[model samples]
Target: MKLVSLITAFSLISGLVEAGNERKFTTIQPDLTEIRKAQATAQPYEFKEEYVPGKVFDRFYNIWLENTDYDKAAGEPHMKDLRKKGITLTNYWAVTHPSQPNYLASVAGDYFGLDHDEFVRMPANVTTLANLLDAKGISWGEYQEHSPYPGFQGFNFSNQETYANDYVRKHNPLVLMDVITSDETQLSKIKNFTDFEHDLEAKKLPQWSFITPNMTNDGHDSTIKVAGTWSKNFLEPLLKNDYFTEKTLVVLTFDENETYEEPNRVLAILLGDIPEDLKGTEDDTFYDHYSLISTVQENWDLPKLGRNDCGANVFKIIADKTGYENIKVDMDGVYNNKSVEGWFSDKHIPLPPPHCCE
Candidate 1:
């Protein structure tokens, strides 16, 4: 269900901090005050110009805004899947369009201001989520769905079936392999999702696990239904397992919104052993990929990675672990079906078809 609360006042500034030799800055914390001001200035549930076009897409945006229900959208069911065995990010989001940019954003927060995917070698100064986590002695892995090794080119990114497991990892081959392969523990963490099944069953997983499901299963290569099904099949089983829940956080998020017109659009859900006060309740707080990076760093008491260190904080999706009321429905108020009707029609918003679908 959707919960709407009017937010109020604050000073949302943007800039950098230079203390001694270290550079510091704030993440993209939503200006609740700004949101409240905008809400007060505009009518409730009205579509903002940024999220809608003239007439067609505006209708969709208006409908989505009015509905305001997070549960209405299609997503995985059965929290007992294999992959979601711990903390979940109900309001997680990726930074930009296309998988590469979002992936980089998730790891480095800001994509280094690159507009397109270019396989150039990243500089030593370019810090990643992995780097930050490592600096703090917290182990982490990218866990590309099909990769066997951990390095700059370990993540598979090909359309072919066989090549998927062995393709290069980044848009730019210029990435430093040392940064990727230096950590033995972190490198060992990278594995195929299928490889995690044995670990899940054996109750042998690392302290902090960061997984990147295959393109097809994580809403990148196939229908949303397919993605949901795969998520439920793999992640749900683990969340329901007691062995994985003691002190873990699980996050499943979309890399970016389906359309550019809906610029600040992405899906993130959190699940796991969070404080009782922050479980099960849905939060509408504005957030993005960088926020997640910040959250992780904050959780582990590590220094912030690159731009995301102070960009945004993940919205508190569930605040109490009492478990939700299990309210599943489509946008039309239909029970069972998860897909929203007319969510992306020509009548709803003005945007090109989804990149993968097209």
Candidate 2:
């Protein structure tokens, strides 16, 4: 009996030793020499030619409306007017389900795993398109309607009696990024819509500007008709102005769709100084939120963030002039996930509260 027990113990010890050796061999780290060699072999993309005057517009303005599906916007009267007057991008899609992630992805190359519209702050190290614009000495600003101050960091502001949403932090992506909020100078650039008018009057508008309407006007707490009417009224005067019309590109788009089950297709319009031949035409090229960042990079010959922006398609006009090539990607595979429920469950974070003002 003692001899049998000794032999069994020896067999068990040998098995354990073999398992340990297997793990050690499989988990070996790559050496510095191998890393250097891999980096050396990587090829960087080069543009065919330097940026030309007509390749990209010098000024860019983006207006992001709230949750409205493509159907609703297509049926709206004012939306049709804008479509008739400007170039329409019929194949544009939102990057994700919620509003915040789409907005973040528009400025930053990626959404950074944000699945909720909570008042969450991003790490300061995260780079944004504002950083890219700043690096090239281009001016940028965010004009949020009904915001209390230039750099207010609150979650939401509402009217006391009506309880209507005046401004919500989640709608403004610049406030969530620490890179902008940390610097006083940069923070001051994020001003209220009133300041936008003042800047326009003084001809002091930034080269790149993002505009967000209040909850009601943006169709979040109201109907598509309301949002369309407000946009038409606000844009008619600006489109007629010579200062705003010359060498300027204005993009009007939505944050996301109303239904998570449907494809995240949204209405997008391009106006203001578009090439004469392209006006009143439709472009069916596929585009996502990262395309906004990629378009800017192509316009100014700026460096990419090496994230999703690396794979995004450039705007059609810019592509025509610069001979830009888009990275091939499987769109259906990329946007398969619909709701944020799985992400919220995995992170153990509470779901976003319903909009009380709505």
Alpha-carbon RMSD, each predicted model: 19.0, 16.9
What is candidate 1's lDDT per residue for 1-358, written digit by digit as tens?
2211100110011012121322122222224354345334331111111211111111100000001123323243533232233333344344444445555555655443333433433444455666665565544434445533333232234434544322335422223234554554434445544545655565555444456555555555555666666667665565567776545556665555554444334445565554566554455454565665655554445565434345355334321222212222223321211111111111222211212200
Please give, for residues 1-358, the per-residue lDDT of candidate 2 as tens digits. 3423543464354333322121111121234464345435432111122223434698888999988888889779999998877888887889786888888878876665466676666667777899988887778888999866677667777764687887888899888788888987788888888778877886777888899999999999999999999999999899999987888888999999887777888889999987677778998788877888889888988877766677578878778788987544445534423532222223333222222211
Candidate 1 lowest-lDDT run of ten: 57-66
Q: TM-score for each prediction?
A: 0.57, 0.79
- Deviation from native of the Cα of residue 346 in model 2, angstroms: 6.2
Error of 2 at 152 (Å): 0.8
